[model samples]
Target chain A: MPTLPSLRASGGDGADPGRDEVASLTFESVTKRFDDVVAVDALDLEIHDGEFMVLLGPSGCGKTTALRMIAGLEEITEGRLYIGDRVVNDVDPARRDVSMVFQSYALYPHMTVRRNIESPLLVRKYRVDGDGAPPRKLTKAERAARVDEAARVLGLTELLDRKPAALSGGQRQRVALARAFVGRPQAYLMDEPLSNLDAKLRAATRLELVDLHRRVQTTVVYVTHDQVEAMTMADRIAIMSAGRLQQVGTPQEVYDRPANLFVAQFIGTPPMNTLTGTVTTDGGTGPAVDVGHGRVPLPPGLTTRLEEGRPVVVGVRPEHLALSDEGPLEQKVRAVEWLGHECLVFGAIGDSPLVVRQTGLARLEPGGTARLVVDPAHVHVFDPETTERLP
Target chain B: MTAEAVTSPAADRSPEVPRSRRRWLRRYSPREVLLALALLAPSIAVFVVFFYRPFLNLLNWGRFESRRNGAYFEDVGLAQYREALGSDDFREGLWHSVQFVLYTVPAGLVLGVLLAVAAHRRLRGIKVFQAIFSSTLASSTAVTSVIFFYLFNPVVGLIEANWLNDPDMAMVAVSISSIWQNMGLSFVIVLAGLQAVPDEVMEAALLDGYGAVRRLVRITLPLISPVLLFLLVVLVIFGLQAFAQIDIITKGGPVSATETLVFKINRLNRPDNIGIGAVYSIGLFLVTLVVTALQFAILERRVHYAR
Candidate 1:
């Protein structure tokens, strides 16, 4: 594929794509209800200008609904949405000046790629006073030029004459991207746009999207259930569960210091291993959590904040647990997965299942005993009753 | 050791025998063949009895002419076909049928699309509106024709119009009855097509800056073009073969102005004109064939079937 021309060179007036007019999005206590079910409940979030904000969660987490509400595809039942200081709750989707890429890549099947990219430009009702100006239509030549610029950026110039059905899945996705780009909207709302691509293609497209963002510098609100995409691309990740926002922070912040037990388990690939234990200061150590096997010491910083005798869940990431010669914890190995670079050892520690992400080859055999120790700083303790993380 | 050695030789020989026997047996299995024949019998019988036999008989009869009030027959061969097809009566009947098709086909298509698009939304009481639009399906053609006949009667009708007596308007009145009768079917078919379009496609269009009217014209219509074509073919066939509406409302009256091809064929069913009637039947069949072929050739090029 050929490299894209500089957006500045392509613009009629030598405008930089990075300096294009972008807007910040604000959701103020937005709620959407469907009869007896609340799809999104009192959500409050602010996306900065030119930021790539991703809503990450499992199915039915209201992530897609929130994105749709911003696009004005779904009505905001109880709160206000603003794009660039203008409250857009009552605005039509077209008038909101936001473009969207759907999960299905919803290309008009009957239209050629050129026509598909030109559709948004054709219907744009340009306003001067924001109220009563006559709509200014783009000329035929101008529309064609805009379509050509977008196609060149996405490497779709050769396929402009073909219909969507004639293109491959990945090509169709790029066409959808080109269509969204041609409109030059303030924000792009994408709903799991990469979910339909194959794994290898999805990874390649992920990098392309980050590069595109760097060049365009437009605000993007992307929704996906895949944490890998969220971790790699998002400037900030917002995690939602059961129609409520759980945590919103940088990827490292959310991973290293989860707001609750759900975020800890939901954000990682091998998922954090959790064991139920009771906080005990009676041990010789200052503060410790006693599982049935033994008592693990807690860091001094956390011990001062946690009360003794409180029932809590100890959360440890798989990579944090290491094999030691004589460690406090012992488990009988049940399974070993030997990936090329690393191995995953699954075993039971005192009736609680634990997974260890060991670097290099694993030597433990099934049914054999292995000693393990956890990094004290990486340990996370959650209040079992409320399921919230301890300071 | 002796038993194993003996069985090994026998097993090697047995494989060859069964392989060849199985191939031969599979080629003409009696039970499977009988089952396949049984499943296809009903459809084959219907095709032969209703379609093939009638068409062949009409072709054969077109070569003969009835004489002496049906007491005798003369085999005129291709001459009768040419003579009957060239007559002014046959041409007039065909012209009237074409006029009826013009009246009903476009009306049916436009009204079907309008009703389908209106009722496709998720508003409150939408089901009630759909039911009302589809209610005409319950009325038979003869029943609808009678109802319309009385409604447009010059003396006792609600509007008291002379539609059934005017030569210029008798076919128009009969066409009105046919269009009304076809609305329910057209609406249902078009609505099914509209429903098959995914909701995300419409949402994407809206985000791309399409208003309701533009979406219908550019997206909805093109997506449903195949369904509309199917409806067009059906309406053309119905309009050409329409009998009951003309029979009840005009009876080919007002100086034979509204006598379609089918009405002429029905009138020729008398004992003396059976041969000419058969010739007209063949001509109507050819006309329908040509029209349906032209429709597919022209419309299929524009249809975009979603992958």
Candidate 2:
């Protein structure tokens, strides 16, 4: 595990961790509560070894609570939580072998950058691998070498002597990250660590974070509310709302095949357009949805799940809706926004609003009628009662 | 825009009207300035009568020596100032005042922090404990002195020590009451400081593997150092101005061991010795000002103010 050869010159025999397996975190029906309110209700997520998992959600969602539970900063109010092979429901944060980066970049305001990074190694003793040996601390030289390496990796070497008050926001964030990764903990937990940064800096730091995760090869559980950040950096994104897990999949998988209506509306930029319809079999088609103005075809896989005159929700992405004159659906175009590269055509089919993403500016006028088409393969049907995708 | 518009022409036509008339007339209505001055007049008059006028009289009186029990006075000028300041009584009184400061200020800081840190927690009934810790602020100097005097008396005392009679320990006995009496204010202020520290910083320290003791020393203490410095300055002023505690408890007894500068000034403020008393009062004023200034200059850099 001592892959950093540059640090070996100053301190070779520090308490460096040996080849400990990258630990997988398992939340087995875990729940968290704050007085009468449930922050996380029966969350069962198994983050695999070395996976970059982003817990994506809005504010007041249980994403932060779940990350805190993994750090042992919060108590599990209901069930078992595992770090590696050990059930750490009652373990202290230090013994859990995890480090967290907070949204505030909670740097010690009085300490220099070097001291902040060196503090973890100074306070914690690492366990040697493969045997039942006791934990031992690193020597002073080893501590300095590790701090130097971590600072160099984070590009904070020049700022090692400065207090946090003197550093810029991006530099402070880098210092926070350096302090987190200096100790090769089992897993790194971050609670919206980049939300404090501006947009341009957040974009740049997102790549740096993914690069750091690649070099460390440790499991990183990053929590964020920005879907773009999740789509860019996550190996797997877990979407949550109101203390319940909605879906956990790769970025493209979630955008293409949302398990429910919430995930469908939340994952996209313009949000997926939804229309209410009733399933009817009297038209002699295998399964058809009477979408008020016209009937839209349903996929063959949903044939078993369809019932006559049953209300269902039809969904399609904005980019998938094509403007065809001979199409079945007619909408009254309300407004159009030309975004240089593409134009967003906003319209309404009766009372339900619809948006179409067209490449380049279209010759469309406001307060005019337009015919739109949805590909039969791209149609998504959801049960109006359960709000989950059907078939 | 209105302020600038009024000022630019006043600057361009400097010879016409006095700028004060034009400025006040243009920038503000006469009723506005009149109302502001009306609100400020009472404070200014009271300060002149009660504070500034008496201080000026004391400064002028420090130049002359009283004679024949205030029937006559001799303006010996700087000579009287030199003689009174260079006297052994003044030096001894200053030394005693410094000693009192050394004894009480450090105790006030440490014990205050101990009480504040102990009371500032998340457990049940903590507010009750906080109330008890700050209850000492309710005690008057005389009440505290009586309590300590009885607690240290030889015959009827609880602990029964001879410190009040001993030359060296009498000041320590006096300082104990002051430390106890001033604790409530210190605990309340320091607890406010501890509460103002953001919770995320402490939580981050815990997750960074700092144990309880280490976290307090390394994180909590440094974050509250500004409050500690403010408390230090207040305690120093209180220590220097200590008189009632000494009077009620030691009475400057046991060969005047507990006679701080204020106590000496109080004794000197008689009909015959009023000139020297003014000199000593001025001396105490200078000392207090210098010590408070020195504290801010030396400690402000080390104190961290969180943005």
Candidate 3:
């Protein structure tokens, strides 16, 4: 495989050097509806130029639908979408200048890798005069050069002659990437392109995708159900659930300050332990939430927001819980999972299920009782009815 | 280790000879073998009696020439085969068969693909259109031929065209019936192939800057090539064996322009020309075999079976 330098050189004068500058994408109150069902509801998002933004959600959460809208594959029912500064709501998908890698990779099974990569260029009608002029035909050499450059960038030079059926899943995925890259469109919309690969290959390809993003410097709107992919690869992560945007932030921001109960539970493994509790100032050791197990103290900032006897759902991540001999909460242990570096303790506080992440050689029998303490600052309080965080 | 050591010698010494015999007996047990033979007897008897016996009898009959309406017979051997193949009537019949195949096969394929592509979409009332496309499947070959025969009849046809009268156009008229009758089967098969294509692949093509026509040509067609090839084989066989259409429409008339091999063979199966009829039947079999082999050799190379 010829490296990135050769690819850049072969791009020729026809390649726009200013392509990186014009790749910002924005959705202004975009809503997509299918008959009576809403797939995406008033999604307003801004993906910066050259940013690798990931739409992270569970299946049927409308992340793929949102990405399809950007790719011009799905129509926006109610709002305007802009690629750079131009509204692209009415543009045909072929005219939108965006490429997508589907979850199945969707490599053309009949064509060799070279032909698959060159397909976009082969179909591209050349501009005779200017951007909107009458389209001319591309030369065979031009198509070949573009294909070669894309294949080289993705290290697919040797397998260019092989059909997609002959290639492994990861190689086929890279061919899909190369095909999308050959066009150098304004942005790339990826709908879980790595979901087909096995675990190890998915991880390796995920890293390669990040590297490819760095080299290409194009805005990418990637959708996936995996939070780990979002956490590791995204410059900004947009979390959605039930066709609504829950939060949009850096991975750490969404992890630390989830906007609602959904985000707090969805973003982490073993999820956050939630308990129904009443805020009572009568405990007199600062403000405390009287969960059924005992009263756990609330931080001052959260205390200011709570009224007396206000019912709130308190959320604490598994990592935030500590097993202390003299703690405020008692949990009956149900199971223990030792995961090399850390141990996950599954138990219950009264009737509410609780999971605790204890690091380094912590062992607790399944039938035993353990005292657990949650730091006040780490406790998240949400309104029970709306499931929205307080303050 | 101790159990294996104790059992190893006993296993090796006790069963080595009997094991071979037992294995043979197990593979070919009498009752099981009898059951298998009994199960296969019906199909084997049918093949030998209806298929192979007739073919062998045809070969034997091709060697003997009948005279005076089978009142006398003489063995002529391979000369009869040569004369049957070299006869101008047989050549004309074979040429007519080839012409019929050329007319119907390509028309069947193109129309099948067109109908399948048109109907394989997501639209309101598409099922109704699909049912309309496949409605001809209910009509048998004889019924379709009769319908087309009347439809193309010069005196009372809907269009009153001279299609069935002209020597050059009679075969075309007969082919039209076959193509119409085949439309339903071809449409259904091709539709199945089109449906088997993953929706994501089409969406990917759209995202990759392909328009509707390009997507169909580059993605959908190649993916369904196997189905098309299967349809091709079926259409080719149907074209070669065509009889009812020609029988009903032309009856080998209009200068014998539409007299296919099967029609000639049927005509020659009298008491006076049974030898020639058997020879023509064998020749037609070889021709069909060669045509099918050529089609498979050429078309199967281009087919891409989905993994």
Question: Best by lDDT, which number?
Answer: 1
Given the true complex, what DockQ would model 3 score? 0.25
TM for chain B in all models?
0.87, 0.86, 0.87
For each candidate in turn, the TM-score is 0.90, 0.87, 0.91
| Docking class of predicted structure 3 | acceptable
Expressed as tens digits, the lDDT of each residue in B1-307 for candidate 3 is 3222211222212121332454544567789889989999999999999999999999999999997888877899999999999999999999999999999999988898899999998899999999999988888888888888899988878756788889988998899888888889899999999999998888877866777788888899999999998999888898889988898888987879899999999999898899999999999999989988998998898999887
Q: Model 2, stretches more than 4 Å misplaced?
A: A1-19, A127-133, A284-286, B1-53, B138-170
lDDT of 1 by residue, A196-219 (tens): 888877887887788787677788
lDDT of 3 by residue, A234-291 (tens): 9999999989999999999999989999999999999999999998878457788999
Task: Judge candidate 2 at residue B76 and give its lDDT.
Answer: 83
DockQ leader: 3
Compare candidates 1 and 2 on TM-score and give the better one. Answer: 1
The order by descending DockQ is: 3, 1, 2
The TM-score obtained by chain A of candidate 1 when compared with the true chain A: 0.94
Of candidate 1 chain A, the 10-residue stretch with the lowest lDDT total is: A8-17
